[model samples]
Target: MSTQPPRLPPPAPEDAAARNMRLLVLLRWLAVGGQLATILIVHYGLDIRLPIAPMIVVLAALVMLNVMTWLGHPHWPVTNFQLFGTLACDVVALSVQLYLSGGASNPFVSLYLLQVVMGAVLLHAWSSWALVGLTSLALGLVAWLSPPLALPPWFATTLSPVYVIGLWCNFVLAAVLLVLFVTRIAANLRSRDAHLAAMRQRAAEEDHIVRMGLLASGAAHELGTPLSSISVLLGDWKGEAAIRADPRLAAEVDEMQAEVMRCKTIVSGILFAAGEVTGEAPERTTLRRFLGGIVAAWPGQVTFEDRLGEDRGIVADRALAQALTNLFDNAAEAGASAILLTAKLEETMLVLTVADDGSGFPAAVLAALGRPYNTSKDRRGAGLGLFLATNVLRTLGGTVQARNRPEGGAETILRLPLVSLALEGSR
Candidate 1:
């Protein structure tokens, strides 16, 4: 037997800001490319007189910032501070480009709102408000300081129709990119949140199981001494000459002894099942002998049938025997006169089935067979048997399933994959 603590579930993940930062970085590159194209098209194709050298310098600075950002991406998580700074830098860069071109008169001025909207969606309220302030300051500074861009040579003498067309293009581009990117990022955020929520729920369930296991272990320890004393008293009564003279009294004493032993068995089983104590070290034994021992110990008539061609040797322990005993006990308690205990080899797995000739399990009981405090019995503290049995098998990488038989009674199937059991035994 191996003593081990209850396994805790893995921790829930943090927010999905890292991927968001990567997306923002990629979008920045596209913005840069778009800015360069627009600059070239207006200056060369449209024959507009502009300060090309200064505009190129600002674009170069933006590229270098993006490169540094991309390089540092994998090193740190994207926090609120990082996102705020990134968006602030974007605002500043866009402002500078707008200033170099046409200040507040630039058609791309609405692009500022894109950053504001994204900040509201992806960042804290304070950070989003901070971005709004920074953009407002940038707009004010650009309006007050920068010179307006000149129109094309042909339209220099009149207000240009091309400027109106540029405004329409900027509106369309901003709307399309915002819709596409924001929708995708929102979906990613939703998925990340859903995963984290599931992890949290699983963690809660694991915690509940751990608490129950600890409580069961504590109860077992508390009951040990009292059970031992009762066993001693029963043994003394059995040995009494006067009591032994009466055959009926002797049989009753024998029954009491058996009941006491069952109590002791249950105490040890609980502790072992909880992994609080390693009751006994595993021993090498044949499947037949293992199954035979459990069947012999059962209080009711349990018929054992081995369908395997040949019994194979494996590591066996008290926990495995106790679990099988629990199944048998459950059948007997359910008014079963006889239980058919069968063992067989199915491919690389060992299959054990316990079928009873009692009334079948209720739908509710069958549905929640192995869950703690979920049982058909009215006895107080009676449900832990199947629960402990299920957990014990699970620790050995096996599974237990219960269902009602169509003809009558209930059937429990326990399967242990040979490969996993071998691996466990090796460990």
Candidate 2:
């Protein structure tokens, strides 16, 4: 994650969707390939005709499907019903082989357990247990009611009842239990996968929105220069007032000037937050000295306090200092004469916290805090502060969250990937 982009242009939404789909496809195929290789070794290398041949074929076909999907071939993935369909075909195949080989006493008669487990993994709870029931019934009926064929070249003349009972206990009961727990594991996997997909989607969408805001901010900045020039000319003309003293005209003109100035300020803030204009990277600043430097630079009236971890540190990008400064300024604006800051290392993550005893986020701005066009800063361009902070952190493989403290103040928590801390430590 530390190796992650210091900045990223949010990827297109379509890429996110495709990426999730591909992950599932890859996982499915990997499972199929492993299973098939196991089968090939069992059948060819060992000459054991354990009646797993049909399942081996199934695994092989699944591998092919996975490969095709990965190679840009699109088809619905193997859903529960498809898994069931494959098993149903296998059941028919095995049933015929059972009749030809040795009926219920055949060692391979236990392979129905495989189908039961597979079904359990993909189906809902009720459906999974139902599949288990159906499998038991089918295998039981085949053993009980169906006629037994002659034993194979290596099997018994006739099957003993004890042998059949033992087979049932070993294969059937174990299969049932296997399906039960495997279903649980698979269900958890499905839920976890869903959660991961949702998280990625959120990150992707957030990235996209931020990129759009950046573009809009850039445009606003470009527009600001001309708007400011026009505003200055309007102010100069307003002094003359085309023969002096139309109260309505003067008020309207003043409103226009204010609006123009607002646009200009907003654009300037955008440029600043974007790091569009920056001085050379200052002599490499470590997390501790850099932040200390920031506090040192704060105005005398405000107490800019900071603490850093012994192990965790940041390289302190030239622009990153400004980003951190913006956060401190926000604290100052909140009427805080003093700000408390602390940095800590937790394993591979660096957490930076900033808190102001001053008033928490104002009620009006609380709802839209990180949104690009909103800011509590009364000045026009102040909205870009949080956005700039967010983008900087994001680019650094980190996160920033703003929340009002339950007791009284606002807190902004910044988390950076531990990779940066690791890099700093190694140095």
User: Global lDDT of each model?
Assistant: 0.78, 0.65
Error of 1 at 66 (Å): 39
Q: Which predicted model would earn the best lDDT? A: 1
In TM-score terms, candidate 1 sits at: 0.50
Question: How does each model score on TM-score?
Answer: 0.50, 0.43
Candidate 2 minimal-lDDT segment of 10 residues: 300-309
Error of 2 at 62 (Å): 33
Q: What is candidate 2's CA lDDT for residue 187?
A: 75
User: Against the correct fold, how does model 2 do in TM-score?
Assistant: 0.43
lDDT of model 1, residue 390: 78
Q: Total backbone clashes of model 2?
A: 2
> Taking the tens digit of each residue's C-alpha lDDT, what string does model 2 give over 380-402?
66676677677778777888888
Runs in model 1 deviating more than 4 A are: 1-206, 274-283, 333-338, 357-370, 376-379, 382-386, 419-427
Q: Which candidate is the best by TM-score?
A: 1
